[model samples]
Target chain A: GGIITQTPKFLIGQEGQKLTLKCQQNFNHDTMYWYRQDSGKGLRLIYYSITENDLQKGDLSEGYDASREKKSSFSLTVTSAQKNEMAVFLCASSRTGQDTQYFGPGTRLLVL
Target chain B: QQQVRQSPQSLTVWEGETAILNCSYEDSTFNYFPWYQQFPGEGPALLISIRSVSDKKEDGRFTIFFNKREKKLSLHITDSQPGDSATYFCAASLSNYNVLYFGSGTKLTVEP
Candidate 1:
């Protein structure tokens, strides 16, 4: 049983500040994903990578940038924090072509 | 536009009773559906799933009922326990696609 680990359980950022969230997985899965969770909004996909160095945009990818520098790691960067924005960012991974995804603990971000 | 929708934003049930959660989708092209359960301060985890071709899928106390014609599905939890309390999300995706469209989620509280 592999685990997905996310850094910085909580984050506080100022308006227009840049913040980055990191994720690491030990499942050796070929796909990694980033999702944003907001109250009453469920979860929205931001970006995903099929393999190392590969990136694909999702429905909510406009304000985020993602990187898959290694097979075991995926990272997301908030280009510019929005004021009064509070959301939880989750990282997930799965085997390519498989629908079962394992998620990390998540990082809660509050932009002041 | 949200592709997936879930009803009953929140629900409360007593132990030994049953809890039902409803979900619907707008895209008929979505052939795979998965339900994820998330506890407070944690990321979501795969609970159970059903394919479009199957009307029912069961795993222990959790069951998924699918109605392809109506583009609707429901999750039924029998013999509820306090540990079953969590937020449940309904997600849809194509069989070959890696992206998933998720519903807002239903927060279920089981009283013991």
Candidate 2:
């Protein structure tokens, strides 16, 4: 059994400000992913890492950057927060070639 | 373009009744399908899943019916309870690829 932890459950940022969210997992999964959830829009992949220091862009990776500092940690950075932007960022981990993914509690971001 | 789509954006059912959620995909190459359930202020969790080769998969009161020829799948919840109320997302991915394409989600409300 393992748990995924996300820091700062709530975030408030000014427009055009940069924000970073961190995630850590004890599952020792080889793949990590960051997803953005908007109201009624479900979850959209931002970025994913298959291994340490490996990054792959998803459909919604235009304004975000991700880092897989180690096998247990992954971080996402919002380059420039947009005004009135409100979304929940989720971090998930899974073993390579496996279909099941474990998710963190999520970080809710509000830009003013 | 969205690769996955869900019907009935919102649904309400009474306790002891059944709830049905529909999902479809555009990419024929997608071989794995997963359904995730998310409560308020939380990240999505895997509820049930079915592979293209399987026509059905069941876990307790949750069941997934898959139609590979139609590229469609449905989730059926029997004996709905208030605790079952949440947003359900349908996701598709290839067996070889780690990326998942998710639907917009269906918000189910079980009225007790």
DockQ of each: 0.86, 0.80
Model 2 DockQ vs. reference: 0.80
- Give the alpha carbon lDDT tens digit for every residue of B1-112 in model 2: 8899999999999998999999999999899999999998788899999989999999999999999999999999999999999999999999748899999999999999
Error of 1 at A100 (Å): 0.6
What is the model-wide C-alpha lDDT for candidate 2? 0.95
lDDT of 1 by residue, B1-34 (tens): 7899998999999999999999999999999999
Query: What C-alpha lDDT, on a 0 to 100 scale, does residue A65 get in candidate 2?
Result: 90
Quote the positional error of residue A20 for candidate 1 in Å.
0.8
Kindly report the docking quality category of candidate 2: high
Poorest 10 consecutive residues of model 1 chain B by lDDT?
B93-102
lDDT of 1 at A8: 86
Give every collision pair in model 1.
Answer: none
Q: What Cα-based lDDT does every candidate model obtain?
A: 0.96, 0.95
| Model 1 DockQ, alpha carbons vs. true complex | 0.86
